[model samples]
Each structure stands twice: as C-alpha cells, then as structure tokens.
Target chain A: MIPPRRRLRRPPSAPWTRRRPLPDRVRRRLPLLLVGVAALALGALAFSGIGDGMVYYRTPTELAGHDAGPAGRLRVGGLVLPHSVRAEGDALRFRLSDGVGTVEVLHRGEVPPVFREGQGAVAEGVLGPGGVFRSDRLMVKHSDEYRAAEPAR
Target chain B: MPHRDTCPHSAVAALAASAALVTGLVLAPADAVQGEAQRLMYVHVPAAWTAYTAFTVTAVSGLAVLARRGTVWDRVGRAAAELGAGMTALAVALGMIWGRPVWGVWWTWDPRLVATLAMLLAFLTCLAVRRWHGDAARGARGAAVAGVAGFAMVPVTHFSVLWWRTLHQPPSVLRPPGDVPVDPPMLAALAAGVLAFTLLGCLVVARRVRALDAAAAAPAEHVSRAALGRAA
Candidate 1:
C-alpha cells in the first residue's frame, strides 16, 4: 500500500559512515610525530632572535666603525687593552678596541680575577655617564676546538 | 533531576567555571615583592598549564585517530592544538610585558622560557602540517605522528629549572617553598584563571567538532537539497 520511495528509509544516524581504516604505518608512527613537533618547537624558541639580551663575541677591530649608544646593552668582544684594567672601590675599569675606536668600560660589580689586560673577554652591560661602557657581567671566552695540549690532570 | 540535556547549556561546566572564577579573582594574594605587578601571574601560570594540557590532549587524540582510522580524534586533536596555542601565545606576551619592567629585559634564553617557547612552535607546526598535507586521511595521520613526537618536549619543559640554572625561577606558587604559602586570595585568582580557560578550551573544542561534523555532512546535504529542488 505504501509507495516504494516512501518505504525506502534509512536510519537517522546511518547517514554518517566510517571510511577506510588508517594505515598501519601511520598508527605505528603517530607517537614519533608528536614527539618531533614538541622538540622542533622547543629548540627553535630557545635559540631565536626574540631575546636580544644575549650576544655573540666580537673583537675591537670589529667595533672600530661601530656606534655605541649610551643606553645600549650589548656584548663588546675584544682583548682587554694592556694595563687598562683598573678598579676604584666599587667600579671596575677596562678598555676594548678593534684597533680603531677604543671604548672604556666602567662596571659597578666585582670584576672576575681573570679579567686582566690582553685577556679575551666580553663585557655584557650598558654604556653610561659619558661614552663610558658600563658592564654588569663579564664572560671569559674560550675556544671549543680541542687542541693537542700536553697531557695534564 | 535526570539528564539536563534538554537545556542547551552544560550545568557542570557552568559550576566549574564559577568556582575557577572565585579562585582566580578573589583568593589569590598580591605578591609581597612585586605587588600588583604580580597580578599577571594568575593568567600566566594558568595559560601555561592549560597549554600543556591541550598539547597532551592532542597527542592522545592523534593516537586515537591513527589507530581507529576515523575522523573523531582528528577533529579533536586539531581543536585542542589550536586552542592550546592561542592561550600559550597570550601567556608568553603577557610574561614579556611583566618582565621588561622588572627584569629590565624583554626576553631571555633561560631554559624554562626556551622550553615553553619551543612547545608553542611545536603546536604551530602540527597545525601547519595538518593544513598543508594533501590527502585527508594521510594528512591527519601525518599530523598525528608529529603530535606524538612533539610531546617529548613535555618533560624537558617541566624539568628545565632542575636541568639548568637559568634566569627563570621554578614553580613558586604551585611548588611548596614559601613560608607564607599561597594565601586564599592568590589561590582564588589562580583558580579563576584555570576555570575560565578550561571552560574556554572546552567551548572552543566543542564548537569546532560540531563545525567539522557539519562540514563533513555538507555534500550529502547539498545532494539532498538539489534533489528536493528537482522534485519541487
């Protein structure tokens, strides 16, 4: 008694179908993908230019033609000028040059004992009070290339 | 008394939201040191926590989609990743603004900070993979794999303080150390941040899932509409 079109009915939820099963290779590899995403993201962020505070070492020769601003904080890489390292109570003094423009640094902190003239060091801080570069921290520069130094403990 | 499905809103979610709100806004105390400036911590800590939670969810969902070969987990995974990333990005920006004035630096390569930034990038990559990969099934599977691999950063992020003596401090409010402890005021603020965002995360995920369903159903709907038009 009912028309064929009317009687040909599908269940409401049956309209949706589950397609092909995911390949076995993908199933086995999902964990690896997740882990990869986490690592790449972390590594890129760690070394990004987003934080401009940290710096790469540069020599006085490199800074010869450079302009040093009063409020700027950056690493000045150079050999400490001979006999230029001095300390007055709280302020420590040093000079760095790329053999062109020698910049004097006055730091208001304890100077590392190794901070002496002709030493390879980078002063990390701001320039202040008359073209004087003031450093809050200093790092000793060491080359990572392994050299054949005489065997010693 | 029974299921409240008849109501369009989720009562459980609503109640949870209310509780979280009280904790974030009223209970958390102002930092003895930073004072009002410390207020940023409420949203901050929560954003990071929620970001971690969201990424974890993606990993699980990615796995599910791969194993079951269905659209269910794929949709869930993408939704969680996007939402997680949105809040985490917000957290990093807020943290930077807070740090500039206090720490005198806009950013640092501190281990924990580095790890969190990495986590954000990983989530973005997963989303990118999903968008660009061509085949539906293959793309979902590929992204799923990436999601799982990306999770390796989780432990690294959490333990960054222990592993490195970086500038960033370890968990202070959450970790047990301060004599004052987290006062009720501070706790309340943190709770609110968590609640608001968790609900927000769920809300976004649900809406996304529904959208995916509608999009999936569109072809059939279109055919039906055409057929109906012909009949008329």
Candidate 2:
C-alpha cells in the first residue's frame, strides 16, 4: 500500500504568506505613482522662473523708470506725439507720450495705415541706453469712439 | 451606421452658440486699440479655451485608460485629442487674421504663438501614432503617454505672453490679480463665447465617443457569432 502523503502545514509567521499580496498590489500601482510624480516635477520646474520672464504692458509713464535689459522687449501704449513722426527711407522715427512722459521710438518697417499723429498707438521693442525706445513693430489703437469719430471727420 | 442616440445637449449648445454670435458680432463694442478686427477675439479666445478644455479631457481620459485598461477611456481620449487639435488650429488661424489688421503683420515669432503651434503639432502626432500602430493596446498606451506628457506645454502656452517678450496682448479679462482691464460689456460677451464653445466641444466629443464604442463592439459581436456557428 502507498504511504499517505504527509499533510503540509502552513507556517503562520512565514514572510511569503504575509508579503505576497502587498508586492502584487505595489507592482500594479507603481506605474501610476511614477507618472504622477513625473508630472508634478515637470510642472514645478516649468513654472519656477515664470515671474522673471513675465513682460507686462506699460504706458510711457509707467515704463519711464523701469530698466529691463537691453535685449528685453516691452510694449508702451499712448498717444503718438503730433509732428513727432518722421520717415527716412524705410526707417521711421516718432515719439509716444502718455501725457506725463514721452518715449522716443525708432522703427524700421512699414508703419500701419491707421497710425497717425495724435492717435492712440502701441510700440513694442527694446529700450536703448538713452530714453529712446527702438521698436520693430507698431500697432494703431482704434476704439469704437475713434471709428465713430472718423466718419464725422 | 446611423447613430440612434442623439446628444441631449445638442439643442442647448446650438442655441447658446447662436446667442454668442449675436452678442459678439453685433452687441459688443469694437476694441479701442484693434477696432473691428478685435472682434476676432470673440471667436479666437473661445476656440483657444475649448482646445484647452479638450486637451485636459484627453489627458485625464488617457490616464484613466492606462490605469483601467479600458477601451471606453481610450476612445474618449482619442476623440478629445482630435477635437482639441482642430480647435487649436482654428484659433491659430483666426489669431493670424486678427494680427494682420491690428499688429500690422501676418505672423511673428511671438512665444505664445510658437508654443500654441507646438501644442497643436504634438497632439496631432499623438493621434497619428494611435492610428498607424498595428497593435491596438501598444498604440493606445503610446498615445496615452503622449497625451499626458504633451500637457506640459499647456501652462507654458497660457503663460508665454506674460513670461516672454511677445507681440501678443496681455490678458485683459482673465488677469488673476488686480482688476479686469476690459469693460464689463466686453467681458460679458467674451464669457458667452467661452460658454458656447465649451458646450459645443462637449457635444462633439460625446457623439464621437459613442460612435467609437459602437465601432469597437461590432467586430467583437461578429466574431462571437461566427465562433458560435462553427460550434454548431
């Protein structure tokens, strides 16, 4: 007669019995945890120095005392000084004034048709060593009032 | 196949969108700086907002797909991404048209514009990868990773105007600090536009997801039927 197989007894203190499910659970969740951590890290890094790069729009008066670096570009909006605009070849020179301060502008492109003396305009460029604002682009600021006022003129 | 289930929000979305068009095109006053051309903002801003919303949906759904390994989430993610990419392209094109009249140029190396273009390209690539891959699961997993990783560009795009020397205008209505620079009426019109666009995007995505579900199920049903017939 074959000897009956000895019954295998489970050890209550065995590490494998206690830890098996935990590892399987951890393995299943590890990818998700990794993705979350990576995204969080990337977000933090991307926004870290955002303030330093933020370039706010300012009027001539507001931009008068501010010194962004030579390469720094900013926008100044205000009325174009009457008779302050002059064109030489392709370059245009003008002054933008906000009633309190006047910033000189030197542009090297075709000025927009709507841009005129005594009209509202915004200039975007870098500030030179002097008080001059060297602009590469000029935009005319036309309001509904300006359009309504145009037909009358 | 004819779609039997109609989107419940379709009528509401259509009504809201029509109202937004009227408010934006007729009721809203022209901008002081950009004049009539500024009207493009009504469409452009809303489109951009919708794109952002869609991409967020894509990312979330993508994450769900990976975690659950469900076809439902994968289809939702794909639909959202496709819609988001299209909206982003529309916004970019509208922006260019507006820029031509206001900024006096058709295009510029503005950081905001560049970032937005990059986002559009990245999402389009994600969709392409999903389409071309032969293995469904592998393709979906790859797309999910792309959808999630590509979101890193969204914050950058939104903040580029503030963070970089850009020709693009700064936030007027959405500024978080201080006061809203835009007039109340203008802000109201913009809000309406955003609402309409968001609702429209949701409707489209919902319909697309349902279609995808039907398509995915049909093949499985056919295969099961064929197996049963062979057994008989």
Per-prediction DockQ: 0.05, 0.06
iRMS of every model, one decimal? 17.2, 13.0
Per-residue C-alpha lDDT of model 2 across residues A60-141, encoded as one tens digit per residue = 8766786553455666677889999898678898888879998888887768866788977777777886777888878765
lDDT of 1 at A40: 70
Candidate 1 at residue B177, lDDT? 50
DockQ of 1: 0.05
In terms of lDDT, the poorest run of 10 residues in model 1 chain A is A143-152
Query: Taking the tens digit of each residue's C-alpha lDDT, what string does model 1 give over B1-232?
Result: 2123413445656776777655545555445444455667777777888888888999999889879867878988987888778877888898787665444455655666777777777787777676343356776887798788877766788777666544455565544455434555565667677777676667667666655665556654344344333322
Q: Is the docking of candidate 2 incorrect, acceptable, medium or high quality?
A: incorrect
**Model 1 / residue B108 / CA error / Å:** 1.4
Q: Which CAPRI tier for candidate 1?
A: incorrect
TM-scores of chain B, in order: 0.81, 0.90
lDDT per residue for candidate 2 within B39-143, as digits (tens), equals 788899999988888889889988998898677889899989979999999999999898788767776555677778778866776676563344578778888
Q: State the local distance difference test value for candidate 1.
A: 0.63
TM-score of chain B of 2: 0.90
